[model samples]
Target: MFESIKRDLSFIQGLLEGDVNHQHHVEYRGLSRLVDVVDLLVESVEQLERRLSELEEYVETIDEDLNELELLCYDDDEEDDEWDHEIEVTCPECGEDVTIDEDDLDDENVELLCPKCHTVLDLEEIDEEDVETVISED
Candidate 1:
């Protein structure tokens, strides 16, 4: 497309330069300048198109790298599943909800400290209905 446009502009430039015409006057100088401006604009547009193509390819490479990194870091099935479990217990003193990892509760009678109020909580005595379910995320 640039080639065809450049060819037509070249033809117009030749005509304006008085190579194929006898009217070599100052009144036709504006036509010559207009063709010069059009030629520069075409070249600038072609360069812009090339730059856009390069940027698109770079973005695709970055996206692929991110996906590969995620797969490599989270390849273990057990570890990924562990992150999906979470336990939510409310603090009796402050009434604030505290989230704890399921892995941290190794036994039935485990003691956990509340982060908000620094109160010790007994996980064994808490009823299941009082404990809220909180999903863990990576």
Candidate 2:
């Protein structure tokens, strides 16, 4: 790719200096038309590079998200894999739902408090119905 880019740049510079050859008349009009063609190629190459860069960034983001998701709690104890593992953030005292995820239950000892009512809810506090609803939306 770098070699190709360098060759294109060299071609552009040659065109700019009007050192390129043509079969017919060697007029400025013909060179100008050829420059326009090069300009289009350069613009297209730039656009493709930008798109590839964006795709790379998207892949990186997905990788990071996957890393975070892997840390989510998986159930091997009382509950089955399908519905046993989940994270729950809620008002512990009031039972109001806040944020829920599979990672919430990763550690049973951890307790998260709700911002609304200041209630402490742990991974066990989260309900299966809440998990079902949240998973459906995701």
Candidate 3:
């Protein structure tokens, strides 16, 4: 599209250049001014086309980056879904195994009181792999 416009502008510049040198003094002056204006307009349009192309490439890059960011942010549902509702842990105080529901867990660190002997258990202190092993075995 831009190439077509540039070709048309070049044709007009050639015609104006010829008309500017004609013998009619008054008409020649008007044609000369028109030629200068046309040249400036063509140069401005070319610059605009260049800038628009750059902007298009920039927008495409941003779109790709946003797609990657979306995958990183929300693509872990499968991994998260592997864990079951209940997590089994061994109480350190009473040495009794206990099953706790994941839904009952709070946001902050809290005690997992064992029902067998009322032993206070710190869930974070237990290795996650051990808990996963027990849960998976069950």
- As for TM-score, the candidate ahead, 1 or 3, is 1
**Stretches > 4 Å off in candidate 1:** 19-27, 74-79, 82-119, 122-138
lDDT of 2 at 111: 70
Candidate achieving higher lDDT, 2 or 3: 3
Residue-by-residue lDDT tens digits, candidate 2, 34-119: 76777677778888999999999999999999877665533342235445333444454776666555665676766767777876
Q: Kindly list the per-residue Cα lDDT of model 1 for residues 33-124, writing each as its tens digit.
A: 78889999999999999999999999999999999988887777757776577889888889878887777667766678888889998876
Superposition-based RMSD of candidate 3 using all C-alpha atoms, in angstroms: 7.5
TM-score of each: 0.56, 0.35, 0.45
Report the number of the highest-TM-score candidate: 1
Better of 1 and 3 by lDDT: 1
Per-residue lDDT, model 1, residue 78, is: 54
Candidate 3 segments exceeding 4 Å error: 1-24, 77-138
In candidate 1, how many Å is residue 85 off?
6.7
lDDT of each: 0.82, 0.63, 0.72
* TM-score result, candidate 2: 0.35
